[model samples]
Target: MGTLDSDDLKSGVDLKSQTDDVSLVDERTAEQKKIDDWLPITSSRNAKWYYAAFHNVTAMVGAGVLSLPYAMSNLGWGPGVVILILSWVITLYTLWQMVEMHEMVPGKRFDRYHELGQEAFGEKLGLYIVVPQQLICEVGVDIVYMVTGGASLKKIHDIIWDGAPKIKTTYFIMIFASVHFVLSHLPNFNSISGVSLAAAVMSLTYSTIAWSASIHKGMQQNVEYGYKGKDRAETTFNFFTALGDVAFAYAGHNVVLEIQATIPSTPEKPSKGPMWRGVLVAYIVVALCYFPVALIGYYMFGNEVDDNILISLNKPKWLIAAANFFVVIHVIGSYQIYAMPVFDMIETLLVKKLKFKPTFALRFISRNIYVAFTMFVAITFPFFGGLLGFFGGFAFAPTTYFLPCIMWLAIYKPKRFSLSWCTNWICIFLGLCLMILSPIGGLQNIIKKAKDYKFYN
Candidate 1:
């Protein structure tokens, strides 16, 4: 009787301990669920695939497109076309890889880029590698857009009233950023779909106007298809910088996984199918926007082309003004698309790492601060071309060109001699070169510009 009672008491204690553990886990998980529900990236899951399409269109085709012609001037005819096409195909492949990887594990979704990174690289290492590059890419793009938006606003003012009192570009950048102060508060990706779609339409609109206007202006007198650099060393540096510009133009990959996370997924259908479809649509639109603006703009202006093609086309005052207006609208949407991820990152750090409550006050203060920071940077530097090249190679190249390939190889691990392996290795090699070389030229160009530039002018 004594032995039986002892055995029963031990069994009861074990059961009670297990039950308490279960209860604690359940409570912790429920709290996590609430936090996820409030964060912008995870707050919604009903977005359609076309939302991916326009969101991507808005993200990829921003101020960078305007610089394509200038990139061609530095790269010249043969190399420029080859590089542009290669980037399109390579980025598309990597983007498809990301979409596939989004749900590769089955029954779970990698809702953010870093989550996918953690799956490939260990948890801490993954955050270290991906988060910094992703932040630089997103935040860098937002800052560039601020400069682009402000410049476009200034263009409109110039065209509308050629001799009117000039407002400082600083004020224009500030005005552009003010719009985000309100739009940034929207809870999630799906909520901004309408704005994204409008931005998409504006991208196509301005691109068409850009190319058509270039044709309307006809070929310039003594247009030199020759390289702009006066010496071999200068030519080499400009070539590298141009690569960064092209890399910047194709920078949709940084947010591709996040875009995929918005789509509804199921075992029966999978999110990749719809997401891939949207990617195809987005790529087609990209090709349309990129090739014409590049080829035609370069053909018309050649070595003398302005860093921004719109600045080169000054005829037909109303039409040029309209294009500038479209640019402002497109970048307005672009800024939000990129800023969404940064917002999520900030909010995540506050709530999860810092233990701040998820509240309106926290969100309001944090997001506003971010906007102000970017605005201040934009006003201070305002070197649109240099900024694009530097950020594009430093951050965009890895995220768009090679990071996905690295992750795919790491996770999937195709046979060493296989076609998949070779293709990925080629992408990795090219991306690594772009990452290494492009920034050197970009820094040189920024230095050159800074020598003659005035701050906040």
Candidate 2:
């Protein structure tokens, strides 16, 4: 009888222990669920494929397009066209790779770029490899957008008022950044879809105005098709910098997985289908916006064009002003598109890593600080062309051009010397070259600009 009683007691204790373990797991999971639910990237998963379209368009086609003509001037006719077309093809293939990889692991989705990195590179190494590069790319873009938005606004003020007392570009940047202070708090990607769509439309509109206006102005007198640099060494440096500019223009890839995370997915029909559809449409728009602006703007203005095409076309006063305004609206949306992921990373760190409560106050304070930081950088060093090249080559090259390819080779391990393998390798090699060379040129350009530039002017 005593043995029977002891057995019952032991069984009861074992059951109780199992129950406690299950309860603990449930609690932890529930807490995680709350955090995921609160995060901007994972808060919603109902975005349509077309959301991918405009969000991508908004993300991809920003102020970088304005500089394509400038890039062409350094690259010249043959190299410029070849590089431009090749970039379009390579980036498009890489983008498709990302979309396909989104749901590659059955029943699991790589929701963020870093999450995908973690899958390919292991937990610690993945974060180290992807997070810094991704942060630099996204944050660098926001800074550039600050300069673009402010510059466009200043352009408008200058054109309309025409020699009225000049407002410092610093004030204009602050004014541009103020919009983000409000928009940044919107919580997630899906929430900002409307803003992104508007920005995408504005991108197309302004791009059209840019090329059309160049045509209207006709070729400038004494336009030189030769490189703008004064000597061979300068010309070579400019060529490197121009490569970065093209890299910068195709940077939508940085945000592809995050955008896909917003789309609804199921076992039977994955998110990639709709996401690809949207990407196709977006790419079409990108081609339309990019090719004409680069080719026509260069054809007409040649080496003398400003970094931003809109700045060069000052004639038809009202149209140029309108184009500048469109640029402002487009960049406002682009800023949020880029800023959303950074917010996600910050919130994730605070809530998950630091154990801070995911409260409105935390989000408000953190996001405001980010906006202010980017605004300060933009105001201090508003060297638009130089900034593009530096960020483009240093950060954008890896993420947009070849990071996806590297991730693919690591994950898929395609057949040796097969088409996929060769293609990815080519991309990886070219991307590495861009990463190494362009920053040198960009830094030189920045130093050259700083010689004449007064801080905060």
Candidate 3:
């Protein structure tokens, strides 16, 4: 009436288009689902004890096995084990903060990490910091595993040949890694969940079995790799510094969240409460799964601990072979599963932004590029030397230490900062302090790696 004014017309336009914007978002999401690569680390069924436990081993155990020796070598047993335990505690604190964030925005499907970041820290912050952090963590993890696997190959080669391989071993890792992806269950996840679980079980079983056997065989005592001792002060400094890598081994809380989101609960309604349930159980299970192996491995190779402990063992030929088998399987599964985001970053730039979906041939070419990039970055670097420091300092650095208290402040705004709140507060503060310390280990390890390459060039 009264010839509806400009304000009225503007309001009408706004009301009319709100639905359109939402619909547009839905359309875009649906389109995204069509192309493979939507999930990173979720299993199809809400698996039970096996799923929760296996994921824990797969996610947390890799770095621990490889890096415990090196971590303990500098820090020695007392400092190393204590730091490893403390790092787990810190990670658990950050992990709860992660869960707290999801609670804040329950209605929206806060599936992707960036979405969680968007809800917690606003859109721009999520885009700039959280997402980038996730990408960096992922890339860093890629570097760690690829390097470790390559080094494992080198180790096996050297052992078999009675020294380092005559062959250009990097080429084998590249080819083997590439073919593994091709042969693995394709991009869809349900197919691979069983294998992932199986790999985790086999690796865990083989690790424990081999280690227990070795222990009985009197292989558990500390053995020197014969390197000159570090100065007392320098070694002490390095030991405290190496906590970062141990923290890194304990930093797979992200994967746990992804897992928690997937596994169905036994409770009729699937409440978030601890029925000793999926996500909650996952947190504890992963911790227990990791602790013993790390402790035992450190015990086996004190001060000489390098990275992967199994390879450190002076054992029967078959035991080393079995351990190597499990490690290789573990690495391959991890690579295939985690390789998505790397591809996503590339595709987002090319297909979505550039508006051209690559042909199958083009996609294959991209995969090759990824493999080449992975091998070079890993092998040319520490071959897993700096892995513990990198993840501990970077991925876990932000997520575990700083995020919880800030997230609580942002979302819950608790007044007295209840016991629940205080726990998170300490975690956040401790995480920040530890994160500050996390990189020193990495820097020294990088230097160590650079200085010695295969005892040759």
Among all candidates shown, the one with the greatest lDDT:
2
Clashing residue pairs, candidate 2?
Answer: none
Q: Which has the higher lDDT value, candidate number 1 or candidate number 3?
A: 1
Q: For each candidate, what TM-score against the reference?
A: 0.93, 0.93, 0.78
Model 2, global lDDT: 0.91
- TM-score quality measure for candidate 2: 0.93
Clashing pairs counted in every model: 0, 0, 13
Candidate 2 segments exceeding 4 Å error: 1-29
Order the candidates by lDDT, highest first. Answer: 2, 1, 3
- Residue range 1-457, candidate 2, lDDT tens digits: 3455888899999999989977985776775888898999999999998899999999999878988998999999999999999999999999999999999998689999999999999999999999998998888889989998998899899989997999998999999998998998998999999999999999999999999999999999989899878899999999998988888899898889999999999889899999999999999999999999999999999999888787788789999999999999999999999998999999999998899999999999999999999999899888855866776686789998899999999999999999999999999998899899899889889889988888886
Candidate 3: which stretches are off by over 4 Å?
A: 1-53, 76-78, 160-165, 180-185, 219-229, 260-276, 279-289, 304-307, 348-351, 358-365, 382-384, 387-392, 452-457
What local lDDT does model 2 show for residue 399? 91
Lowest-sum lDDT 10-residue window in model 3: 267-276
Q: Which residue pairs overlap in candidate 1's backbone?
A: none
Candidate 3, residues 1-457, lDDT tens digits: the string is 4798999999989987977877875786667654434333322434454454555556655634555556666666666667767776666556666654543544333445666666668988866766666666666776667765666666666666675437665655675566555733254334556656765665566557544754555544556533225576566447545667666666455454454444443324341333124345545555544556666665565555545566566567666766666677776656654555455456556666776664556566766777777667665554454654645476667755666567667667776658866776777777777777767666766666666577213
